[model samples]
Target chain A: MSPSKSPLIAVVDYGLGNLRSVSKALELTGAEVIVSSKPKDLLSASGVVFPGVGAFYRGMENLRERKLNSALFKIIKEGKPFLGICLGLQLLFTFSWEHGDTKGLDIIEGRVKRFEGNVKVPHMGWNQVKQTQDSSPKTKDLFQGIPDNSYFYFVHSYFVVPKDKSLIAATTEYGGEFTSCVCKENIFGVQFHPEKSGPLGLQILKNFIDIINDSQT
Target chain B: MFSKRIIPCLDVKDGRVVKGINFVNLRDAGSPTEQAKVYSNENADELVFLDITASSDHRKTMLEVVKATAEQVFIPFTVGGGIRNIEDIRTLLHAGADKVSINTAAVENPKLVKDASWEFGSQCIVVAIDAKRKKSVTSNQNPEWEVYTYGGRKPTGIDVVEWAREVESLGAGEILLTSMDRDGTKEGYDLELTRSVSEAVNIPVIASGGVGKLEHLYDGLTLGKADAVLAASIFHYGEYSIKQTKQYLKDKGIPIRL
Candidate 1:
């Protein structure tokens, strides 16, 4: 079958994976998705998706093992539209307190911490996300047309606590208002699984695809 | 605030969705993928597909059903029944399942819960408990429920609350609590059994079984204090839609996503 003219979205597969659902969801947005471990895919694609589940340390280790770590940094540095989900979002931070102190990609200035107090550990199920205001056009477009405080599916024990509060794109209440989304220029990371978030989640992915299509010009 | 989830469970047997009344008298609903899409489009928070096929050879059929559903239906779904090992969990996850629920397997070897949780994170491990209320001499006596396995056909003799606590310690992210007596009777969820287990575990407890109407769903979340409610007959037979249930819950002052 001949390839469509849609923008190619490369989903980084570093072994700490949920590659199938992520890629399938991306494909649903009419984008050509390539689930690959090769750095070439990341560099060549119009946009990149760094989706993951499981441990932050294990995710980083797998990225390093496959030599996709530097490739990811290069893609972000090159101003390519990038989106991270769940652990993928956590992997962008400076370090995490999960298990022991584990260093992350340091792409964003933040520390990942576990939920404390009366809150549930996983923070699972549907929760409302309130979008934050930022001057970045990309940040605004990320949640464009999507209503503020819309419910998104979340399932994570640790959340990113970014040092630069301005980078936070959205916040959700659990224990007490943790960062649900982070945006810096073209880099976007969401704590919830947009792929599993139903229609609104599909809308979020469609927005990301729109961002990618808009960036091509 | 986190919204209470309303899940519609589909029991798939030989690739079709079926709801067995008390684990027998099976009634065919429709295709697994079709029913899943309907529930998803209706905005059900999550979906659970329990493979009730007795033969192990039909596992491939279930996998195909899962793959098809994952491709079309874009909601978080959990697959359960006969998931006995790590490979079963891994295969289901690879097929695009968000979580896997283990029942008989987890009871036989509690290590599977620890190992699966360690390998794939506790967030994806859901321990399903099918419990039956034990006979009590007097109304003043403290009530007790015993865990049952093999589609509620065999009793494990293990106390429900204690087992729930044990699984939570074993790293289960959530518990799918089903009351055997209330499962098909439609007398509403076994509130006592649900509350006991919910109070025992810190992780989320999804109250399942015996949901006949919108009020039952409300009762499960309010009185039972379960994080989520799962029902098959009400949804499978189109007695009530997820939207109606959520609206009813919302009207009744329960936090639900509509």
Candidate 2:
């Protein structure tokens, strides 16, 4: 495929609400965005952004129904940049216990577990995220120009525990340290909503756009 | 670490701002989308657009405002006031509202809270509770708060604490607790009412109404044990910028993003 002047980013629309904010944020970062539920549209894009908010089982069910599962697999296998947000991030893991034992895409080996003990269930609002020291150099580039401990808007009940420790890009302290960001090869996932996270969050999206632009060259 | 949030609330009517915004650089001050852009640029953690429009026909105007704001502003925002059913919530969420708050509707139909949270995620469903101190309490009895409906006009006679617990159990992710007595008086938040409901629920509680000064904001987060504070007048009157408020909270040893 010939490299276009502007990278077209496909935001996977697997029957979830609130894709407007995600697509709008990406558009502001100078990337052409197409909120598409069609699998072929996702495969043709330079980068794919999988964003959703809801139950893990419902999200996977929609993906399978829309045939987005195979498109996502192809995007990752073909080395296209993939960014996942919130439930989009959780769906990349092995499985989740959200409504029951639900299987995920297994792109990353991990279990989506609930927040237990005395802390709040959803873990809503702003929290500081520190980049893990073991993050790879390319993963560190994801946080480029973003200050450490910047606050991001997060609203989630479950957290991911990646089996491969190297995939952990950042950790945040809720009751204890849980993986907030994960990066491996061309895949990146964040538990927080970067679209809703203000400037620093926009910077993360800008960085992803930059990565896509660089790869196209 | 979780930072206590300082959210600025805007009263929008018929897709325009009802309250005066004291910010200097606004091109169109009355436009809700423009004001939202200014607030988001001022480092506001989040925004709440309370549509006080009386007629249900004006909801389409509010949806346009939400769509415009979502297109321009990057921060998270919640739209409340006059939301009645699941269809109303779905439209706002689809139009780019990160969350939709239900007050009178949630009180009237408790099952709406359960069904809405079940359909959309609980994280996007915020149940706003307007509570007033129950009158005629004897000296021997502990002071209690009664839930008010229809924008704090009618008393529901329901215990504020019990209502908060019920909504949380019904799958509310957060509670926007507003004290009616202290709303316009500006003395301070009813710390007792706030703490009781905050301590009773496992979800995050946002203390609303009666923030006269920076100290009042500090007290609400500390003594009231609230996860966030929502104020309209203080930020509107140019009394303090969001950065100044966060700085004060941070100095008071409260965990806030600077």
Predicted model with the maximum lDDT: 2
Q: Least lDDT summed over 10 consecutive residues: which range in candidate 1 chain A?
A: A1-10
Q: Where is the poorest 10-residue window by lDDT in model 2 chain A? A: A1-10
lDDT tens per residue, model 2, B17-115: 998777777899899999888888878899999999989888899999999999999888999989989999999999999899999999999999999
CA-lDDT, candidates in order: 0.88, 0.91
TM-score of the A chain in model 1: 0.95
C-alpha root-mean-square deviation, candidate 1: 3.4
Tens-digit lDDT string for candidate 1 (A1-217): 2234588999988876467777888888778999999999889999999898888888878888898888988999999999999999999999999879999999999899999988767899999999886537777778877888999999999999999998998999997999999998899999999998888888788889888888876
DockQ of each: 0.75, 0.85
What TM-score goes with each of the models?
0.95, 0.98
The residue-level lDDT of candidate 1 at A34 comes to 94
Query: What root-mean-square deviation over C-alphas does model 2 reach?
Result: 1.7
lDDT of 1 by residue, B5-117 (tens): 99989888888777632322224236788777778877899999999898999999999998888888888999999999999999999888889999999999999999999
TM-score of chain B of each: 0.94, 0.98
Docking class of 1: medium
